[model samples]
Target: MAQERDVNPWVKMGLELGPVIAFFIGYNRWKDDVFTIAGTDYNGFVLVTAAFIPLMVASTLILWRLSGHLSRMQILTLVLVLVFGGLTVWLNDETFFKMKPTIIYAMFAAILGFGLMRGQSYMAALMGQVMPMQPEGWMILTRRMTWFFAALAVANEAIWRLMSTDAWVNFKTFGLPLALFAFFMLQGGLVRRFGLDNGKG
Candidate 1:
């Protein structure tokens, strides 16, 4: 089994990011095209959801092959995508797909919150290898992340309900990822402050 470190980070990123990119492209390309099946008309969102499910499955498989295994969070995400995406296509309703992100974010927030209640940091369990830190740091970061995820869940719910489909697609494809990146960037000070090597000198 190849160690995760042996794999390029960019390749891992592509595996995760490719499906979202394809969903965005697929929706835009077919947004105006309607598919009629069994006397039901389906829109671009349904079309993209149908295509995205297989793409997600393929990407998850590739990531597992490269990393040797998938984390619990990764597995959860794949399952949710399949479940929600399938519902969207099968029922010919876009609401299921729209609710998927809110469900995912809420679940993560709940998971982290449960861990925190038990005095454990599930975030550390998931991210410790990538960011070694003191237990104190992990706890603090986890607490913040739990709340952050909750906020994201609320934001996603608001966005999809209040905005147009195109706007939601853009937010999901670009805005959400960028927001997460910015959130991590903002935590640089915390990372340095409670890093495991802080007092080694």
Candidate 2:
């Protein structure tokens, strides 16, 4: 893995978010075009879905080349995107793409929930190398994240069902990141209260 100094926060954010932004742009620009793929004419959504898979793969590859390793969460997300995105293009349906977020959030919730049940905190396992914290802190944070992911899954389902495609795309591209930022900020107190003191102190 590359050292923290090697990864610029702004660059990391751009690499992580660029594909979704590309999809949003691609969709809006080609929404009126009917493209033929695999002997089937597809709508703008499918065209965007097709484009998304490659963009995501490319971004992930770039990240790996830069960082020397991909995080577990990143790999899981890429796999889901390819699966759902491929289905969206192959089946000429947007439902698969729409359901991708729900699946991702639900899977995370389930994984964390299962870890909690087994007296394990997967959050610590996932992030402990970077952020040292007390075990109790990990437990609390894990539970909070589990519920938060569940809530996001539900919210994604509701928005996709109740809102237009463009609105859902906006939510995915903008609202989700905002919510995540707020959530992280809200947990600052807990982190401070339960964080472990390294020898550097």
Candidate 3:
């Protein structure tokens, strides 16, 4: 089990990011073998799908065993995995794996927007364990994240649909984390300006 102190943020990020990496690697390395997993005459998509499912399942299991239960982010992430992951298998399409992040982003955008519309800051609830902040701070941070996630969703769709697969792969592996880290850095500065808990927040 992962305690608060035991969980390295970057390692947490990696565990969460692993499936995407696995999909890219598997799809590229075993493109032919991917479809051949169930039988020799399977669709090319099935090969990738077969590889994608097991990695995602293992990742989720490890996460559950470590986190012990679903956190909001875990719940949100798992829903996308199960849905897109299933689509990958059922439709035998590798594109489903590639485009899964868009769904994840869209779900988050909607959820955060809903929280804002309801006069609550649910994003704050999700992150509160790792970072403590005042109620006012939470509200402000929530508002910031609401748009950030919404914009990310739009960007994800554009990136995957319009861009080449190699470009999308590079973006997923390198681009998204940089964007997230930059956004958080900017958010941290704003939170500091608002005097959120400097030590704990």
Candidate number achieving the greatest TM-score relative to the actual structure: 1
TM-score of 3: 0.78
Q: For residues 1-201, could you state the per-residue lDDT of candidate 3 as single tens digits?
A: 545335566766677788778766765665454234445465444565566667777777776666665577777667776787688777766578667777787777788788888988896677766676777788888878777877877887788789876677678777888899998888866667655557643
lDDT by residue (tens digit), candidate 1, 1-201 = 545535578998999999999999999999999988788899888988998999999999988887787888789889999999999998888998999889999998999999999999998888898889998999999999999999999998999999999999999999999999999999999999999778831
**lDDT ranking from best candidate downward:** 1, 2, 3
Model 3: pairs clashing at backbone N, Cα or C within 3 Å: 34-47, 35-47
Each model's backbone clash number = 0, 0, 2
Q: Which residue segments of model 1 deviate by more than 4 Å?
A: 1-5
lDDT of 2 by residue, 51-134 (tens): 889989999998888777887889999999999999888788999999999999999999999999999999999899777888
lDDT of each: 0.91, 0.89, 0.71
- Model 1 residue 76 lDDT? 88
Alpha-carbon shift of residue 15 in model 1 (angstroms)? 1.0
Per-residue lDDT value at 168 in model 3: 74
What's the CA RMSD for each of the models?
1.8, 2.4, 3.5
- TM-score of each prediction: 0.93, 0.92, 0.78
lDDT, candidate 1, equals 0.91
